[model samples]
Target: MEWLVSGLIFLHVTSGAVALVTFWLPLLLPKGKQAHRVTGRVFAISMIVCGVIAMVLASFHLTSPQWVEGAADTRLQLGWMMLYLGLLATVLVLFGLKTVRNKGRHHLYKTTWILFLHGALALLAAWVFWLGWSQRELLLIGVAFIAFLMVPGNLRFILRKPVAAPGKLRREWLYQHFTSMIGAGIAGYSAFLSFGAAMYMPTHAFNPYLWTIPTILGVSFMMWLSKRQPRYD
Candidate 1:
């Protein structure tokens, strides 16, 4: 039973890791249409499964409740849940619209959504920590908000036009997208593996925030390193 459970957890995390790289590499690196299409399919299917499985397993675990309430706090808890759910639905709608409106640019839209997962996951971590009232929960607060910032960054640089200068363009579009995407892929793998280990380890609970600090610094460093002046004709 122990080994079997561990294996399932490993599968779930491994899938998400592959999905992360496949999904984001194109966005960050921008290889070409062919590579983009192949990875996109891989990422989407993998993540959906990962999320579904994790959600189910979470039911059996003794994690903290979603909310705690005093009289006035009841509405706040409801609002919090509603806000996250509503944003999730809205993101889906917008991405769907982007797919339709920019049919030729499907990768752009999809990557944006996946990138948003950083914020979504981080924010969720924060909430879990807060509700659990665990001292360790405090760790993820900054990381979660930073994930939100990535939403705009991807939108401006990725979903929109290439911002790099023509002359300074050492690497091509697909390459840059690939780096970030692959970096994300690697990051996902690292985080997922970490999570899986935590999940089954029985020692410390799977604190999603475990990866938070590293993620924050890593993202900032990479973004700075990767920035370029737009190539103007």
Candidate 2:
């Protein structure tokens, strides 16, 4: 069982690293280029593999507490963290893919489904925060807040109106594509910073500054890059 967990960890880390690297290639390359498409495919596949393996490994931790060598409380905390991170990363990437494909007007059914998921997640996060406050679990409270923030964007999709064609008036699909991909990139970076390279960081590395770095950088870069996109004229 130990060996199996170790193998899953190795697979998860390796795929995540691949995703982290390949995700940048498409951002640098011109849109609609073959290289961009190929690299984007690689990045998407790697992210899916990484997310799936991460959840599987987290399940192992949750089911077999004896297999974990850390303090019992710490192990349990880590298990829940893994599950949350895995779900977040996987769902975010999947939604990013969906956004790119949704070039037409938003469908009520699709938006409603997504809205339901985000609403449920937001409620869950609120419950977690309340529970954490009662239990004095600072980590849980912090994570729950982050989860709450993630839901707001999904909420927007439900309220958004139909958009014009590409470059006509509001290039909604293009904007969504840009935002979703950059959001995925932020998630990839955060995972790497929190887990892959965590050994090099200080013990008190879970602060807001550390967690928000990827998001801040990614959004700034996206704004600049989107400006460079060719106009319809």
Candidate 3:
């Protein structure tokens, strides 16, 4: 059982590292190019792999608390947080990839599975919020607030018919793709900083603010990127 957890952790860290590196490649490279597409695909797959492993690890933490080296309540809280993050990462990457694939065809993107994913996240966000409020955990509350903001926009994007011009529709897809992929990067970096880096550093030396650094930087960059309308070639 210990070996299994270690193996999952190893895979999760390796894949997350790959994702963090590749997440920037597509943005740095010329968009719509072959290299950009290949790197983007790699990043998306890495994120999915990492997210799945996280969910599995979370399950172990939740169901087999004896294996986890923490207080029972702490383990349970961490398990739920990990599971939420895992689902968030998976959904973001899939949504980003789907936007690109369904370019100009918004209807194709509004599948039942996508809707279900959003719904699940929404419910999870509320539960996390409640948990955070009850426990007075600011991080979980902040995360839930962000989730609340995101899920609605995603749902609106899928449900709303594209009444705009064809070019506008294309741009909307590009924007969503950029936002979702970068958002996944933010999650990846936050987890690494908060959890992975903490493992190496002394508990007292680790600043909780490190968790918000990625989010602030990522969101600022995303906003700047959103302003520049790149050609959707």
Q: Please, what are the lDDT tens digits per residue for candidate 1 over residues 98-188?
A: 4334433434554645557535644664574364353344323333343354345444444465444655542333323433333343334
Q: Which ranking of candidates, highest lDDT first? A: 3, 2, 1
Among the numbered candidates, top TM-score falls to 3
Compared with the true structure, all predictions reach lDDT values of 0.44, 0.67, 0.82
So what's the TM-score on candidate 1?
0.46
Candidate 3 lDDT by residue in tens digits, 27-143: 999999999999999999999999999989989878997788767776777777788888888998999999989887877987999999989988987997898889887667766
Which ranges of candidate 1 are over 4 A from the true structure? Answer: 1-14, 20-30, 62-126, 132-134, 151-187, 199-233
| Candidate with better TM-score, 1 vs 3 | 3
Question: What TM-score would each prediction reach against the true structure?
Answer: 0.46, 0.78, 0.92
Higher-ranked by lDDT: 1 or 2: 2
lDDT of 1 at 44: 50
- In order of TM-score, best first, we have 3, 2, 1
